[model samples]
Target: MDSAKAEGFAESLVDLINKGALAVMISIGHQTGLFDRMAELKKFTSQSLADYSGLNERYVREWLKAMAAGKIIEWSSEPAEFYFPSEHAAFLTRKHGSDNMALYTQYIQVLASVEQSILSCFYQGGGVPYSAYERFHEVMAEDSRQTILAPLLDQILPLIPDLTQKLATGIEVMDIGCGRGKSMIKLAENFPNSRFMGIDLCAEPLESAREEVRRKNLTNIQFKQADLTAFRPAGKFELITAFDAVHDQARPDLVLRTVYESLNDEGHFLMQDIDGSEHLEKNLEHPFSPLLYTISTMHCMSVSLAQGGLGLGTLWGVEMANRMLREAGFTQIRENRLPHDPMNCYFIVRK
Candidate 1:
């Protein structure tokens, strides 16, 4: 190997290792509300920050040192003070809404929890189930709330012409793989005239969805636990939605076909999926390729395989998704993108 190239690669590896450690620290900072508390202060000592946040001072001090070393927070040697810059806090705090990168950083720890199981799957043939991962649904619900629910009314719904007006005028709508039913509940609350139903295979999140619906006193929305692979609706829907749900299914093709058949003749299907390509070469310049693939291997693909389903993986890509849609009897399809979300692509399809 060339000496120069070897040295450059060695440096890159060191940077990667440090960034990985920083990710875990960032997750802790976000979860413990340290970032939020620090954002409220201009400059303070570790003990003062811990007192303000009501956390253990020793642990807080250690985390602060890690953040300072990583250059995530400003450090001053004169009086041993630290400052969490507003500019950095903008993307780290929950108050920042969908722009919060700290929320996404939690996935690094979540995925790391399954490292042993994933390693076993490497040597063995089977995969880890969804139930194995803790707080996964919770994380996914927060992710959906920010990415989908936050933009549903102003950005997402308008993708299909006259869709909002149709919902306002009363239409039967269904959301497949509706985890926690946040989207359906939001829609039901906004458009009281329309009837909404959310279906998923997991009962835990469905129960949580029902609780939220009851808490909101929403009569227009309902939740059901059903396997999408063999789902058959008693009544067809005027609108169907699948937000980042289809690709990881045991049988995405079957699920898509069912969605096609379960819709009215004039119904519209709004699907949001990962924005990628079928070819590996095409993803060379992808911003989140490494993270996306790691998540797929650890969670998405493994869960599907555990169910004895097709491990389609997360980056099934636009070409593969379009071909599958067409095969499922969708002839008219249009792809759309939003300014806020760069990770997914939206599809407007009509039967």
Candidate 2:
């Protein structure tokens, strides 16, 4: 091996390990509200922060040391005070919504919990089921509410012209893989004239969705637990949406075909999915390829394989997605990118 190349790789590995540890600490900080408490205070001692957040002081101090070492927070040795800069807090605090990336760090621990099962899948050629990962839907619901629901009304739905007006006038709408039904509920509340249905394979999130609907007294929305691969709706929809969901399906191709069949003649299908390439070399320069591929292996691809279906994975790419949409009988397809969301591309298709 080239000595320089080996040394470079070794350094990279060290950095990776450090970042991994930092990720776990960041998750803890976010979950414990330490970050939020720190954001509120200009400067604080670890004990003070723990007291403010109602967490144990010892654990908070240890976590703060890691954050300081990770360069996530500023430290003063003389006073033993830590400062979480407003800039860093912008991306870590829950108040920041989709910009709060600390919410995503939780996935590192979640995925680690399934490493053994994933390793077994590597050896045995089958896949780990969704039931293997605990708190997945809970995490995904928070992610969706921030990323999808946060922008659905302004950025996402506007991708199709006059779509918001159509929704206002009462059009049939359905969301596939609508985890927790947050997006559908949001739309249903905004457009009382329109009816909404959210379908997912998991019953747990659907139950949560139903509870929210009841709590909100939403009359225009409903949730159903159904396998989308064999999905058949009683009535066609004027608008169908699948947000960051299609790739995880056991039969993405069949589901896309079903979406086509379930749409009215004048209906539109909006899909939000990862952006990359069918060709591996083409994705080499993509910034988030490493994280996206890791998530695909640990969750997206594996879940599909559990159902003995096509493991298209997360980086299914624009070329493959467009080709598949055309194959699904969509002749008019327009791909749009949102400035805020760099990880996914939005597809607007008409029957």
Candidate 3:
């Protein structure tokens, strides 16, 4: 309403649109591997880059200029040379501690689900649709293991001495919703004494998981098609994990109880999931949070509701989770403070 306020509002609006466009450009650049290649030699002319990467010259030329204009790179307009700016090092190149390319590129699936965001699951409820159930199961698992699980294990496993003890001699573990078992392979290798069994609903990702296991000669890992909802753990589990999967189960509280009963006494149940809808405004600050919310709404919630049209799977908040875990009768309900940033919370309930 005031002049200053109006000026600030105008700037904010411009920044909003510019940011959206910038994200698209950055994602395209990463998908095109422009930054990675550029970081290799540090500098190259547009023509040379097009030839090197075998991309269309005109498209590459325009893209490079846009990167310069977006401040992602600096352009020598005289000779048309493009040099990657420092930001690329901190994010686009692996030199940056986080790399963050996976954060951007892997999240493209959210965009794929954008069309269905308006199809409110509230009107329909129970029954995960046939197609969505399959897709959601696969995508969510792969995304979770890639983006969060390894990082989680790297952080949480050390906290419990049992894991380190096993790593000394090696041990075996089970991963729920293990999808293609990419993360499990690494976990198996990390703790040589550890073998991992990954269980999922579909045979497709499970097959891939099996292939990866065989490829690595990881005798410690295996894949199975099973539902955590009713499929009891085959044996005592040393380290059990369901990254963002268990919370969406038809009966989540029961699933938590199942996880509780399945674990060896004192073994940890690590459930990495986002239940921060209570903090919608705050969630925007964390990109993955928003992306997860979008997926939960479109694919996750939508699919869960598809079967009988039950909207029971619509994103549940922390309070409900706490209530459910309490009802399920878990002994301890400590939040894994450092497992995930605030946006993605983990319920480290001790069995």
- Model 3 scores a TM of 0.81
Q: What TM-score should be assigned to candidate 1? A: 0.98
> Sort by lDDT, best first: what order?
1, 2, 3
lDDT of 3 by residue, 1-351 (tens): 699999999999998777667667776766677677777757889888888887898998888877787788887868768887666656775445434553454345444544443354455433334344324445455445546654656675655656667655755477776767766777787777777788776677787777777777877777888765678876787678776666556557667777777787867776766656545675566556655676666555655554333344335667667777778777677765552444456677774
Candidate 2 residue spans exceeding 4 A from truth: none
Off by over 4 Å in 1: none
- For candidate 1, list the clashing residue pairs, or say none: none
Candidate 1 accuracy as lDDT:
0.92
**What is the lDDT of every predicted structure here?**
0.92, 0.91, 0.65
Error of 1 at 119 (Å): 1.4
Instruction: Please tell me which model should have the higher lDDT, number 2 or number 3.
Output: 2
CA shift at 133, candidate 1, in angstroms?
Answer: 0.6
TM-score of each: 0.98, 0.98, 0.81
Query: Residue 46 of model 3: what lDDT?
Result: 86
